[model samples]
Target chain A: MSVKHALLALLEQEPMYGYQLRAEFEQRTGTTWPLNVGQVYTTLSRLERDGLAQGGGEDTEGHVIYRITDAGRDEVATWFTTPVARTQPPRDELAIKLALAVTVPGVDVATVIQQQRSATMAALQDYTRLKRQATGTARAELAWSLVLDSLVFAAEAEVRWLDHCEARLRRAAAELDVQNSRLTDGTSSVKREFRRSTGETHADRTRR
Target chain B: MTAVLQLTDVVRVHGEAPHEVQALRGVSFAAYAGELVAVMGPSGSGKSTLLTIAGGLDQPTSGAVTVEGVDLARLGQPERARMRRTSIGYVFQGFNLIPALTAAENVALPRELDGVAPRQARAEARQALEEVGIPHLADRFPDDMSGGQQQRVAIARAVVAERRLILADEPTGALDTETGEEILRLLRARCDAGAAGVLVTHEARHAAWADRVVFLRDGVVVDETGADRAETLTEPAAR
Candidate 1:
């Protein structure tokens, strides 16, 4: 859906051949979201069928040049003004995996967290390195840098969440131990003591 | 590649038996010349402890700490103090600039103490100020400058006399986002110029400036993403 919209938006700029449009898209986005030339042609055909684009003219190289119609311009304007719908969020495999890891017995949750953290951290580093190499201040470079920055921030959040998960797990294990000891001792006094000592809730600790 | 700062299986314990806390437990780390390494962890994860020991501000309870091949554990207090002045530079989150001294004077103080002539130290300070992009503020006192400018002065002081190993502990904590980025840029530039840098920070955005990241947990290294991995990263497709 986005690729179609993105191609439409790019077409709003000027008439372009399939390869040229693909190149422009990749250049602006630093190839982070590479587009196949075939996909570009397919989207262009759909736009033509919808009366939003016309592709009758041929370039010197025999490449069909697709131009946006007035209808296409209107569609692009609507796309710009409208916010992306988030009612049905995309599936996040990492979050799902983490949820499962915590619930499933015999799973080394700490190791899972650590491994994911390292991989995400490595991804963060890669993004940083790419950002460093993208030193140009041109509009295209700015677009690429912003894309890389988004990736870097997302990876950082994932790492921080992993750390928080580890700490929460540790706290839960400690509380479980206290509860187990209380059960063995057959006394309610230790529960009172534990609560008094750890009077601070997770919210309080997070605030700190 | 020679490590400008190396910590070999270092351990540090605070206080005696009953109330003692192990701050660093057998943690080995190295920051090579021309490389910036960021240390990240939750609070009380020995991030600061590792930095202090690396800077020779605090001694490791056991194991070796070598700065430019000089074993800190074998040195006397006076010699180690001299090493801190000559080889290691520390930048704290607070900026820690002396209010009475001008920017150049604050930077020159360490060099002057190390027995550099007054005029020469002053000249070196000016050069360092220029390096941190604050040459025009050389005569301004800490009280007169903005927090960002004061932090620039703090960085100038750290890199003055070409200290081989620069240690920063949340150096941008007091500044705004843009200023923090400028400070990180300065630090990254210093490391790129062949000075080894160890940055202790919790913010991964800040750590992204480093060539590698070392994550600490419970006084031990839990994970590391090294520069080698960074180097092999695939570049974006050609424009």
Candidate 2:
């Protein structure tokens, strides 16, 4: 996801104008992650400022081409070798919403979970459709297909998470109901034995 | 534009009233020729029941089930059996191939039961096997073939005789990921070749191969995705 590193890597291959860089990036990712021409130029300028690349020479069409420097080649090599840092995790809206849904009073958590599952399934279906359309024999097409597969995998994982959340919610609600009934029934031997042995009050049990 | 399989307000109930369990509650669905529709839901959400009802293997407690313009409820047992052998084909998670018969023989059984001559049936089965990309395995027994090969044979049998409606229950469930994908590709190819396919699956990735996805909850249709809607989902932004 590091655009600067991506641009440098493409430059490491060969000199490319802004338009060619954008096109190459989009082609490799199937345009699932479309690069703006301006953004490409901005990254190229930043790379030049950092002495990793030099913008010089002109292609046949009079477009300025960027070439990777020795520093840029080393940067690309390091990028490939280093594991991507995950210390700063990206914000996950779904996880945050689910957390609030569980804690917020009067929220319809089940409906929220179902809605997300449906949406994720729809996205997963679209990725699959795109994948089917991609013949993937060529190198660029195969790269695009891999990008689509990543999206499909992430969407499928989201759906499974939603299903897990729903099940846990249902189980928690059922357990609460059982505890409520036991509290109201003085003759319930399970509750009586638990109170006698652990001395855990109903409030403590509810919190647990 | 005609539907190969249609279920109109279908319902199925189990046991007597005191303990009756409603498996499908007025579920209506249709799969047209050249289309593959995926049915997805949690276990016991009536996905399997819907496939069974569509295939005419189980009777709906109410509502009409139609296949290729024929009302399944109106057919007698013998007539329905004939319909099963001719108009419909079923693929299951398990290959369900006859252990004793070779691949070709197993695929040819349905055609032969429909009264096609033995020679013609075997020929047709070979063609079906070819369509599934396993013509060379025609003489191999199920025990000798890999799981993927057995699944291919199962698909060949389902698609033999150019069955108009194909009902598959988790057809890729028993195979590895790559093998499962190959199986789905075969199913998609068959649907593209004018067979209407109904795939019941819990795996979203498997269901994604279908043209449309229908979700069930507690025996009721809860959500359905449209083809147009699939087009509207935005791609992830460039990082």
Q: Which 10-residue span in candidate 1 chain B carries the lowest summed lDDT?
A: B230-239
Off by over 4 Å in 1: A185-208, B227-239
What tens-digit string does per-residue lDDT give for candidate 2 at A1-208? 7999989998888899999999999999977778898999899899999999999999788999999999999999999999999999899999999999999999999999888887888889789989889975999898899888889889998888898898899989999999887778665787578787997777886899
Locate the minimum summed-lDDT window of 10 residues in model 2 chain A. A183-192
Per-model TM-score, in order, reads 0.91, 0.89
lDDT of each: 0.89, 0.90
Where model 2 places Cα greater than 4 Å from the true spot, the runs are A183-208, B227-239
Cα lDDT tens digits for candidate 2, B29-74: 8888888889989899999999999998999999999999899999
Least well predicted 10-residue stretch by lDDT in candidate 2 chain B:
B230-239
Error of 2 at A27 (Å): 0.6
